[model samples]
Target: MTDLRHRLDAFVKLGDFFKEYCKYAKNQTQIDDNQHAWLKKFDEILALAGHKNGWFTPENILFSLESWAELLTPSKLESWLMAYEVDKNKPKSVALIMAGNIPLVGFHDFLSTLITGNRAIVKLSSNDQVLLPFVAQYLIEMEPSFKDKISFADGKLEDFDAVIATGSDNTSRYFEHYFGKKPNIIRKNRNSAAVLSGNETKEELTALGEDIFRYYGLGCRSVSKLFVPKDFNFDALFKAVYPYNTIIEHHKYANNYDYNKAVYLMSLFKILENGFLMLKEDNNYASPIATVFYEFYDSMEDLKIRLSQEQDKIQCIVSKGFIADEIPFGQTQKPSLNDYADNIDTVDFLLKT
Candidate 1:
């Protein structure tokens, strides 16, 4: 195998470790001191992650780990990379400005940089500082060659040939000004939406709750908006999604729910609520926490055109047969390695850079 193949094998091993650690974590089992040092370190990192960010609940962290574990298998890695010509030329330094909205949100970019034979200079978000570095350490231990290729930046990012930065719409402007001259992928705020045809089964609608409530709807893949047919009965939707009402128990989420509900009521905006999530008639894509903006569509063709026109602001579209690229309900958060954020192919860009 070539050096790149060796690196891919090391990542597959790291994925196996993540799977084992997640199993133990979910069971709350104590790791033996004599167990692999990496396992103990993984335990420490999981604890630190929860302590650093309240939203990084143990369940959510494990969910993220499980998703990655499923995606990083050797066969999956090979399939994802099969289309690209991973050259072993002089590797460029790729700087990554990661997001912390979801656990390991920027991992795809990190993996792309290394798998494509480039150095990664990662600047982690304060909200997500613990997990990726530990994964990097595991990769290094599995294949020492990665030690020189992986780095974490504490200060201004310099000495990089290309950059991949993800942030809110405001920060994207700053990134454009700073890194505009360099070959870069600067991503702004984007949100996902779901389309309801009024014929969805209760089970399917309930599954859609996962797309909305996962990570408390902080991830770009989380469904923040809904497009339902005219005369759609929201009672069924609310009843189906009632299982996720437990999200209100989280203080942060409760606070947002109360605040946003109060604002909408004071503004005299007609809204529907099931005591947990509020749904309002709006056309916007990015909804506030605990609230999902929704719109009524009269024609599927027109809706498709509008969605296509506004594709830049959309991430994943949750539907059964509405569009060719529609993601199945409840599967938005479980994106494969090839599901590049914003539909911009990171591996292809890295290979060319």
Candidate 2:
């Protein structure tokens, strides 16, 4: 078997560990003495991560882990990679500069680098510094061959042949300036949006709430804008999303909501809010935290064309049969391994490099 096969099995084993660990954390399962050590270590890691970054709530951290665990199964990994010509590539030092907006946000690039016979030199975001290294250590332990395949960058990134960097629009310019000479994929800021027709059922609208509120709307895949029909009544949306009302209890989220709401009020901008979430009419895609920007559309065809033209600014569209390749509501966070970010195939890019 190729070393890639061993890497695949190692990831599968790590997935199993994550699944079991989540079960144990939730008290759905118990661990014996042999497993207690690992459980304790992970417990410490999750706690420290939450402590370091207030946005990294324990629930959100576990959610991210469980989401990745579900995707790293044997069938899922093999099926996603089969499309790429991975075996023909020579090893290159791939520098991965990750963004910290969401937990494990840059993991796909790291995984792509290693799974395609490349070495990874990762520079983690300060906001999310701890989790990926723990994951890497597990992978290395699972298959000793991986020890040489992955390494973390400390101060300066050097001797890398290719790059995959994620940052805001401003930082992306710097990434391009520094790494333009190399084979690179430098991603800038992008946000997701929902196209809502007035005819949506309560269930679908409720599901849309997940697309809006998960990770408190920090993830690129989180829906931050809405394109609604003219004169759309938001009573249904407010009511359907009421279950997530407790989100305001988080101090950090509440602070953002309070601050943004105050600024809008002082500026005399018309707004509607449900105490926990606010909606403002605007054309921008990237809304501030605790708020969603929306615009009314008179024609679906025109709206589709507009979205197509602005595809670069969108990570994914959350809707129901609203457009081809529409992501079902509530599933934006549950992306398959094949759902490449920014519609760029990282695995293919690495293999070609």
Candidate 3:
């Protein structure tokens, strides 16, 4: 335990290393020749990670990584370490079943295990196998010890001290049936949403474009549904978001939007009430594709009732008047260094194990 604590303290310095790494990462044009080589590798991995047509642009990855570094403040890291009690050093292994819905979804599990001083056996999703290793490769250059903490595994989950698994609802059943006996942070489908008081101006509404299209609306934290007052005007909202139509040019994204738009149009066989697609709300938070689906409410009480009914399906809700302060939306799944996933503090979870 004493030796591990010293290693953990040394590992903590990597946060400082990442801070510098991010500085090198930020200036795309200014990056030197050697830096460009690594950035090119990252770009390749991004392409392999289901982000065609600059979806995983080097600039965006750098920006997101910078934001991640900023969130890993000294106080924040101290709190995380305290939560895990690195000195106590309860040696445990965590099996992380990664998700590929968005770029770097699996990295949070990696961050959790590393900061908590737990050995992680990662099960990489086929769709995201490239990005995680690429990031880890650079981190290992910063500190070779990281190599001892992370291992890439193929299709086997045994001798684990605990598990953290993320999957669709169907796969969740399988995870639970197979892995429930162990201490686990198992999760099912979740979507992010926002509520409107109809008071937003063009600027604020435009930021909603970030909330919706930042990752092309593929993220669990992406705003899927919006709650609006019964007489809410869609004109202003649509106009604010029109600039993001560039997203429609990406072939894969366009395919999702076009295909789902076709299904929605065919199913409704009518123009939407406000010209936005409306599909029958289901028990699912994930919509079929290509459509922004939402429900209308006449009163705040009604909105709360609706939210309570759908709470299990929701991940985060962004609202002007109806939302509580605890759940932040734009920052969903791109959680703060302290912001735990599925409301479980990973450091705490690991320490308890």
The 10-residue segment of model 2 with minimum total lDDT is: 30-39
- How much is 20 displaced in model 1, in angstroms? 0.2
- Tell me, what's the RMSD of every candidate? 1.5, 0.8, 3.5
Question: Distance (Å) between predicted and true CA of 96, model 1?
Answer: 0.4
* 1-353 per-residue lDDT for model 2 (tens digits): 88889989998988888898999999999796776888889999989898899999888888988998998899999999889878888899999999998888888888888888889999999999999999998888889988888999989999899999999999999999999999999999999999998889988989999999999999999999999998798998999999999999999999999999999999999999999999999999999999999999999999999999999999999988888889998999999998999999898888887
lDDT of candidate 2? 0.92
Instruction: Give the Cα error of residue 146 in candidate 2, in Å.
Output: 1.1
RMSD from true fold, candidate 1:
1.5
TM of each candidate vs. truth: 0.97, 0.99, 0.85
lDDT of 1 by residue, 130-227 (tens): 99998998899889999999999999999999999999999999999999999999999999999989999999999999999999999999999999
**Each prediction's whole-model lDDT (CA):** 0.92, 0.92, 0.68
Candidate 1 ranges with C-alpha deviation above 4 Å: 28-36, 88-90
